[model samples]
Target: MTDLPVRIRPEIAALPPYRQGKQAGDEAFKLSSNENPFDPLPGVLAAVQAAGSFNRYPDASAARLRDRLAERHGVSPDGVHVAAGSVSILYQLTQAAAGPGDEVVFAWRSFEAYPGLAVVAGATAVPVPLTADGRHDLVAMADAVTDRTRVVIVCTPNNPTGPTVTQAEFDAFVAAVPGDVLIVLDEAYAEFVTDPDAVRGDAVRAAGHDNVVILRTFSKAYGLAGLRVGYAIGHPSILDAARTTGIPLSVIAAAEAAALASLDAEDALRERIDAIVERRDRLAAGLRAAGWDVPDAQGNFVWLSTGAETLDVAAAFAEAGLIVRPFAGDGVRISVGEEESVDRVIAIAASVVESLPQTHAGRR
Candidate 1:
């Protein structure tokens, strides 16, 4: 590799950049990114179209959207902070709370962005392995924390793998950590969760855990992925620090308006969410019947731990006109998409599952 003209941090240079799911061709279904497959509600589209003049900067504070979210979550406007997306807020929080000589802990094989965020903050990343069934090992995560630890992130219905942390598990983990440490609950896919026992961030905050910060996004269930609006609910003091680190005017006018309109039309959106949930369950069942050990998927996706067969299986999916996300030797994550895509995915899986090694973990 060639050397840079200016001196750059070796760690930053060594880190791999975040990769998004592959885009699909015209005829293929894009089941790679965990995006909501529904179209924007009429109200939401109108709000974005009628948003403030493009000539001026968006409200630097996004006060109206903050106020709306605060009311819904039973917090003051100051307790809420909005940004381009929850992932951006993650960067801001890491920058605000951790730095050189500090550490950030989260589950490995979870969100692909966590490790990079820590490195970007000039902090060491401590990634605890998930359990064999794909749920977070919260006990191990709490044990990983140390004096140098500044932040702990818990991603529920963990991306790529769909199992969630229970309320009991979250409570126990929070009790294990010191109050001074920041606990970020990255619930980007929370709206897609269906399990009654899964931990809810709103309930956690209501129970009075000031150290906990709940991060949510309109990108998924609200179909606002293009606008990139997301927010955090936490103590004002904690949010204030993240705000200081945030890029000014990152949450633009159209995004804020779209978010507010989506909130108003949430009832209609839930119908769409319900349909996806139904489809996700059926798809998982079909894969299981085909002799695959699919995890308990509560989110709008399913994980097939194909192990060494990952690339081959993903290739088969693409050949079947479905674009899925693969993690080399790990597994493949196929998002719950159009009604027809579910049957198409399982139809392809029926053939691929048989070709897996008999001893593979994903094979039942």
Candidate 2:
């Protein structure tokens, strides 16, 4: 397509383009991206305003933020690695651990970014399908690993479809994999998980796993998505390898300041998170009562198995002034948005579910 003679990797060219969640107009409830509906905590806003040194570059290592995260996770500062976002760290870890002739294992219909990241790193993507209720088939994922498998990623409170792996499930899966294969537990929605049995990464790391990396973010519960500050906790040697792949000076001062401030205002932040969790549970309950096969939603969103009518159901929500993320034929993902949007979402969902045949996949 270009006049200039340039060589491009065919695999890269074949990868699907990344699409962001649809933006909403002023009158619409933008629930497509699972963003925290709450505005930044007042203390965090103050910190961002106080960081006025735009003329200077940020600390490349992000030592302050790293230390803060280490303290929270009860790890040494050297074990913590900071990056712009956890997704950015995923790409780095994939690049660091895998290459041509190697493979990366994760669940299908999980994070939309996983396949592309593996492709870019020149590793083959081996996606195990999710179970009917949308939870990962961890046994299948563990079985997929071969001698050539370089990395295994487990996403808890899985994105798009919201079901988390239990601690027992995670332990069995980990035991099945070879110790040489690096395991990355992506817990971006950890703060929102209300499930008593869900696997928490910090607990796993505390048990002395040398090859596991726990990835987390300030983007969700802490309301710092715009600033893009995420951190990883693992063995320092593994983190040192990942650090080599990151872009220089990417985690800026504003993000670090906002994260630190959010940590300081933990009680207020937890209150807001409590509100979101309550609303999320209510929304999922309402959807299921209305005859939809709503999955276990431990995150701040619910998954509707809309199946073949995914796009149509998504359009109906948009028409009713509620934006949702749809994965074409698979299903639609609706975030637990503002309190005002809840009734509208439930109303539209009920109407849509009634139209489907009782035997349809989305129906209960």
lDDT winner among the candidates? Answer: 1
* lDDT per residue as tens, model 1, 1-364: 2578888888988998899999999999999999889999659888988997999999999999999999999999999999999999999999999999999999989999999989999999999999999999999999999999999999998998999999999999999999999999999889888889999999999999999999999998888888999999999999999999999999999999999998999679889889999999999999999889999998889999988889999999999899999999899999999998988999899899888778889988
Clashing pairs in model 1? none
What's each prediction's TM-score?
A: 0.99, 0.98
lDDT (C-alpha) at residue 19 in model 1: 95
lDDT of 2 by residue, 1-364 (tens): 3443777788876777889899999999999989999999869888988876899998899899889888888989999999999999998899999999999999989999999888999989999999999999999999899999999999999998999999999988888999899999999999999899999898889878788999999988888989999989999989999999989899999899998999998789889999999999999998988889999999999999988999999999999999999999899999988999988898999999998888998898
Each model's total of backbone clashes = 0, 0
Task: Please give the range of 10 consecutive residues that has the lowest summed lDDT in model 1.
Answer: 1-10
- Give the Å error, residue 341, model 1: 0.5
Residue 208, candidate 2: Cα error in Å is 1.0
Model 2: pairs clashing at backbone N, Cα or C within 3 Å: none
